[model samples]
Target chain A: DAGITQSPRHKVTETGTPVTLRCHQTENHRYMYWYRQDPGHGLRLIHYSYGVKDTDKGEVSDGYSVSRSKTEDFLLTLESATSSQTSVYFCAISAVSGSYEQYFGPGTRLTVT
Target chain B: DQQVKQNSPSLSVQEGRISILNCDYTNSMFDYFLWYKKYPAEGPTFLISISSIKDKNEDGRFTVFLNKSAKHLSLHIVPSQPGDSAVYFCAASAGDKVIFGPGTSLSVIP
Candidate 1:
């Protein structure tokens, strides 16, 4: 397994509350990504960071925000949670030159009530 | 518009049989493709991948074939086992950013 860990393996929160999920990697890879997995929808990219302070929005960036202040940690925040945001979130990392064989974390299951 | 699409929602195969999963993409510029497998309650794990420069790439019981002209790719798993049951996703990358398909649930019955 890659040295990637997603904190709070499971979380349950009420709607309209703020939520923050953390992803930590020990590999020092240059690319880190946050993705959400829903039934029948597979995994959709929410946001990603190429380096500290350098990030970009993915296809499903709405209602989500991310920050990478250091090489080892990338954080995703939902300002106001909604039932629609309930999904399994995963963090992935890849080397800058490899075939982009992303290594994924165990995932965080977030449920919004 | 979805750049990568896996039309099949689920597929079932008997143990020891061959399993084939299909994926399609509309982007011509995507030069790299990959497959990831995910078990229930777990994150996806890298399975196999092929570069657009080549037609096929194989690893052990897993093989990936890419058809550039047709803009499609497929994954073949021989002698499929019950342990192989999981959801598989197809992904395409232009650079460091990758787009993924909806995914296909594969069930291998013993």
Candidate 2:
């Protein structure tokens, strides 16, 4: 286990509502990423942060936003959730030296009605 | 366009047999490759990885082989057990940024 935790392990919300998922890491890794897992899509990177206040868009960055004010925490927000956004969200952290091996959190299952 | 691709959706193997998972990439700049395994309701865990500089790397029952010229890589698990059943994802990275494949579901039946 990599000292990574994702809050609200399971969440259910109505469509068009705001949703936020939190990821906390005790390892203080420099790179943190938020990904969504769907049945056929595997895990697609939604957004990532290399350092505090430094964020970048991934392949599927639309309808999603992320923020990292400190080294240990990264947050992903869906401004207006949609049925299509329902998926398992995972938070991962990676050290600079390791062979890019990411340590993942348990994951947050989000269902949008 | 997907840079990394895992064409197989699922594979089944008997216990004590060998399971081979394949991945292909279109990017030539990707110098590092890795494999991660995920069980149901759990996040992916790192399995094994190989660098572009080498053709093969092995760890215990798991091995990764990379063919830089062909732009293909494979993960081999020998004496597969039921515990090995999971979705395996292949990823490629040039630096710290990595791109993942769609993943293949592996079932090892006893």
Candidate 3:
């Protein structure tokens, strides 16, 4: 119910290609995060941004990159997509860095063949 | 290693009955704990949360019980409904970072 939105809700692409996912929020929250959901593994954080131009890696940041150029947008990029990168990606926004709640976007499903 | 663990992979409860989901954590220094519910094909939504200083917190039909001494927590849904059927994930946070458990699928038989 948060104003978070993710672009390219569904996509099928070939391996070794560059892919970027976008997260936009209307709430103007300070924290935005990217996570990939997989079976049995739950959801793993790939990267997060605390503020515009400020970003950090997460537990499963390997082979993934992210950038936040504006307060409303956070982008997750796969330098070169791999089959292993195929998963449902979610974007989240929190009002503060240490807040207990974070609102999530619908999600983006990407498949790498 | 997983900092948070949801031992049960799935659970079933009859409609209008109580549904109890359990979670255990390895780290004693976690500052906060949270529960999230996810429907198929959708991102997770925050259901409830409790701080380390609190033992219990409640909202509507949902309540979270935290036992710091045992490094455990539990979520209880009273009079469970079909809409409550979803995958539940328990997460722990230390400062600004948080870690998630594998998730437990809950089915409410209506």
Candidate 4:
């Protein structure tokens, strides 16, 4: 409902293959984040961008990379897919940096075989 | 180790009854807390939040209570409805970082 959309709502990829998920927002928020949700693990942040071209790793950034080329788009890439990486990925946008509510996209369900 | 924890994995409440969800945190630096609700196949939506300086904050049928000394927080939904069934996630923030709990699934039985 926050003008956010994620490409490839569902994806299936084999192990050791390259995969990328896209998050696009029209709200022009200053912060964007990528998270993975797994059973009993909740949501673990993979990476975040505070501003265009400025990004930082999160608690579970291992084996994942992200880039923000403009204010409207943020990308998450898996250099090489793994079975452990299969999970529901969500993208979020917030007007303020911290201590604020974030609007989330529908989410992308990625399966790695 | 998880900085945020939701000990309960599931809960059930009859329609028109009260639903309570609990959360605990280990980090003392957290200054803000929030709750989000998620339905199946959909991303989470913000429910309620409270500042560390406040003990309680209420919005309509939803209320959030924070106990800083205990590092605990809870969300209460009054007169629960079947439509309220979903997964609830509690989150804490410090500086520029925010951590989320494992989430508790609530089933409001009709």
TM-scores, chain B, all models: 0.98, 0.98, 0.99, 0.98
Local distance difference test values of all predictions, in order: 0.93, 0.93, 0.93, 0.95
lDDT of 4 by residue, B48-103 (tens): 99999999999999999999999999999998999999999999998666789999
Candidate 2 regions with alpha-carbon error over 4 angstroms: A97-99
- For model 3, the stretches where C-alpha displacement exceeds 4 angstroms are none
Candidate topping DockQ: 4
Error of 2 at A89 (Å): 0.4
What are the models' TM-scores? 0.97, 0.97, 0.98, 0.99
Model 2 TM-score? 0.97
Candidate 1: which pairs clash? Answer: none
True contacts kept of 4: 0.69
RMSD of each: 1.2, 1.2, 0.9, 0.6
The number of the candidate with the highest lDDT is 4
Q: Compared with the real two-chain complex, what DockQ does model 3 have?
A: 0.70
Minimum summed lDDT over a 10-residue window in model 4 chain A is located at A96-105
Model 4 Cα shift for residue B50 (angstroms):
0.5
Per-residue alpha-carbon lDDT of candidate 1 for residues A1-113, written as tens digits (9 for 90 to 100): 78999999999999999999999999999999999998777788999998999999888999999999999999999999999999999999987722479999999999999
What stretches of model 1 exceed 4 Å from their correct place? A97-99
Please tell me how candidate 3 rates in CAPRI terms.
Answer: medium
